[model samples]
Target: MSDPTATGPAVPPLDADVIVVGGGPVGATTALKLARGGMRVIVLEQREATGLEERATTFHPPTLEMLDDLGLAEPLIERGVRADSYQFRDAKLGKIVDLRFDILSGDTRFPFRLQCEQSVMTRMAIAALDEEPLAEYHPNSRVGTIRRIDGHVEVDVQSGPRRGTIRAAHLVGADGMRSTVREQLGIGFHGHTYPERFLVISTQVPLQEELPDIAYVNYIADPVDWHVLMRNPSGWRILFPAPPSWGSDEDVLAPDNVLRQFRRVLPDRDADAIDWVTLYEVHRKVADRLRDGSTYLVGDAAHVNNPMGGMGMNSGVHDGYLLAEILLRGHAGEEVDADLDRWAERRRAVALDFVGKETEGNWSALRDDDEQRRAAQRAAWEALGADDEARHEFLLTSSMLSSLRG
Candidate 1:
């Protein structure tokens, strides 16, 4: 599965045209796209073959189109819940503003959000790579050390008995927050952690059927109980701030408390309806640089943001797409490193100025309890709800398209 379009003088012979560490959605997408372009790619992942870790449910329009271009949109759409609209509301279900994807209909073929587990996209990407002979996927290959050599980069991967070193003209660090590539390259990942720990619980009670007022995606504001509730193929997922009374990590995730939280929403529901429960902390961050010589960072390794608007995964996939396009041009006799620098600068700015600020603002809008602040926020939301032009502009930023504007 060599890159059919990879022409011109080539990179020196090596293990691959690019070596990607982290076979999650971002890494896999980068590998698949590069391989399709006729370049050799190898994806190294620390987890087992194929990811089924249920997380990240919202896929924006641009991301859906990219998946379609790669032949995955139909399968994903068939398995996902199409959410044409989402809302901003109070904790008690009083809607403040409702945004319709129809505003973006002219900008994209799919003018809606898809609510499916991140695992769906990961598995599909892996299946696509399996058919690509030029792409190799190695699971349980935890990256150890990273070294930048004369004209290439060296990555040491450790697995059961296959512990060895891999050398490639370029390395992509989609490995995640504490990325080995970023650390060895001496890049700083500066960010702050939210004080309120987050908790996610699933239920089979059919959120939309029971709560007719709610959309497939809903964001509720509450000074003490800010939360997000959404419906997907998996079921109904409710993510909210953990209580201050939580004594220990184990205490908050206990089955009793988890059930208590769900029962609070629907006291009549039985145990069968409650499914999965998880708790984690949220962060907002960006790397010092996206590229350091022959090595480049994408996805979580490069940036992170709160899950308030489901921007993390979407932005990461966008990172992969932008980087792959730049690398493809570099192989065609363009200024390689210079192009990477440009990509890094632009993407990093998006992560900081666009994604970071947007997510933070979303959280602030929901969790702000001050009387004056809440009123001002409500006025803004009302304006967005009433004016078509303003709503369209806001949606552009919310959907991550404004980041591409000149």
Candidate 2:
């Protein structure tokens, strides 16, 4: 562990009202909200500001509305692909149905999914936080230990040459799944990991000519294999399951194996058609609780699920907003302890009941080999598209508006 008082000019004052760990999108959102509320906030991130990876590229409708409230939606929409409709298809049977987001026009001003890399949102939020006089952002900073003293939270951080203890009224862990803050707090992260891993391949090659009817987002279901094809500002991305039987990670990501996977989408394509590839395991874990006295958890620190319905990042954004809202209430002199308890319960329920179930159901339905279940799933999608009322309800849930409203 680095000393708490190492010297560097990058370090700000060793105190804040809120100290946020992990400067990803969720952490940035939390810091931005608290700073906007006039709280002294410090965001410490392990990585440099410009080095964020491209993850969680799909933004649901309510998420856009939330970004709009922060004056961030318009620029993102300008840079992203507005996916008005997304299709569910059978590999053998072709398109089953296309769920249109416009059905939610009456419910939200932005009625479409925005396909932009999550790094974009993080960068924007960090930039916005820069304008807030109360906000201090430190990149290349990794949080070490966290402890509570005298009803105040203290965080030990090492940022390049600087290492110091920062005292704060509260700490929010917006870090990723392997959150240092959460682990140090001894919070139980309970859930199971899927038997298979997910493989993502991004390509610069345009696929529209080959798949004329393909929407910006398409989930192609097969008894033996299911794949998700999506378009972001970068290019087209294809995601599919990689079972343990597929040998080691190196074997699964071999050039020949990767080309074989791409050939499934384009038979004529060669190795040159691919841009980059990655493999990650999916999980359905949720932290036992969101609060441990003055410390809190948000985003993947609180819950993680398969990225089937694109709910992971979007729901994480909602978590940041909700927690900040409740804390702001407390800052305004309201007795928010009861409200804090409610926040924990409400957020956990949203993670497990809404996000986990929906994403898992999606993954299950797409790859299910059972004829009866597949037929029922097909029928349900067909019916949803045939009736405006049913489509409205489905879109409400699909757009994640219903998740927040309830």
Which candidate number has the best lDDT?
A: 2
Clashes, model 2: 1
What are the per-residue Cα lDDT tens digits for candidate 1 across 131-243? 99889988888989988777898888888333688889899999988788889899999989877778888887777777788889998887876788998897889887885
lDDT of each: 0.85, 0.89
Instruction: Write down the TM-score for model 1.
Output: 0.94
Q: Write the per-residue lDDT of candidate 2 for residues 262-296, one digit (tens) a residue.
A: 88888898988898898998899999999998788
- RMSD to native for every prediction? 4.5, 4.9
Taking all chains together, each candidate's TM-score versus the true structure is: 0.94, 0.95
Once fitted onto the true fold, the runs of candidate 2 whose alpha carbons sit more than 4 angstroms away are 1-14, 50-52
lDDT of 2: 0.89
* Model 1, CA-based lDDT: 0.85
